[model samples]
Target: MTEVGKTPWHLWVVGGLSLLWNAFPAVDFTLTNLQNDFWLSQYNEEQRAFFLGTAAWANACWALGGFGSFIGSLLLLLRSRHAVPAFLASAIGLAGVSYYQLVQNGETLKRLFGQAPLYTTPVIWAVLLALIFYARAMQARGVLR
Candidate 1:
């Protein structure tokens, strides 16, 4: 007997959308880490300084998180089981960076960025969690090779 519904249409839709969504962060992380002056110019003085002053480790975590999510999206598209670990890495990196931002730089970020994080962070975490669980579920269902 052959397995039915090995690949679902929603899988492709989710994977494609995930990849597209993650691309923004990935590209932003790359550009900011490289200190791309043109892009940096878009931000105000305080924002620019805050970003430039970010510690190396925090930047590393940002890179890992962004790239990990990007890779996880790709793996999902390819129907590969490796998406699990990739998502895990993304979560770890996000947690590390978020801790630094909230714990160490909260006042500074609030003074500079205002309420943006308050609105965005929760949604970001929600999507990350959903993607993680979704990927795991697909793996458990034997759709991911």
Candidate 2:
């Protein structure tokens, strides 16, 4: 058991890695939403158009998913029990985004990005789920205040 008032090194490592993993998508979503031409140019015209044409609700989900995970990581690093709720919000947001992408826009995205999305989506969920469970466990163990 982790001693009271002492943080285990794994907390720092996991939190740092979670933040690092989520940062890329968060930045991409922010830059794309802002319609920054330079960043958008990284994608092909079809992909860019699809992203530009996202519905506001879907955009909100994407933003929440990306930023929420990032925020959750920060809270986890601070050993705050609030990380549990943050991660739950992130998981919900991710589910919405995933539904839109795989169900509504699947054909368009497959044509543009091929099978990459298939592989990435599962990994994204796995990591988010892991973080959520980890945070809850830490809270129950009194590691989080």
Candidate 3:
């Protein structure tokens, strides 16, 4: 009795992690700058300038990375032929992309000269680990073959 196209519990783990790939756009789209409404920032020239510069760069990176992953995931979905390698690559690549964006995001935000928290590395590690383990299990069982 062989299982094909039927993802086990582990694959769900990977799928769940894969969902994180969409988080970038969520944050980018959901965020709302309250400064305009509150009007507390009256003549904060440096902050204003930094905000403008960072906004442009941050938006670009976030948009690109976020949208790019959407496409990448689609491509990844078609990688069923290369199960182990594809899943492994996606697990690794997602983590790498997250880290890469984290750094870029932090740098862009730092222009504000404020304490900017750009999430952490452990989250990516956890997600990637789950995905990797799931992919490994699926491969071992030939479920993804």
Top TM-score model: 2
Residue pairs whose backbone atoms clash in candidate 1: none
RMSD of 2: 1.1
Off by over 4 Å in 2: none
- Across residues 78-144, which tens digit of lDDT does each residue of candidate 2 receive? 9999999989999888999999999998998899999999999999999999999999888888888
Candidate scoring better on lDDT of 1 and 2: 2
- Provide the lowest-lDDT 10-residue window in model 2: 1-10
Q: Which 10 consecutive residues of model 1 have the lowest summed lDDT?
A: 1-10
Using Cα atoms with residue i matched to residue i, what is each candidate's TM-score against the true structure?
A: 0.94, 0.95, 0.41
lDDT of 3 by residue, 43-131 (tens): 36765554344445454544554444444333334434354454454444544445444565556445544443344446645644554
Candidate 2 achieves a global lDDT of 0.90
lDDT of each: 0.88, 0.90, 0.48
- The C-alpha RMSD in Å for every predicted model, in order, reads 1.8, 1.1, 6.9
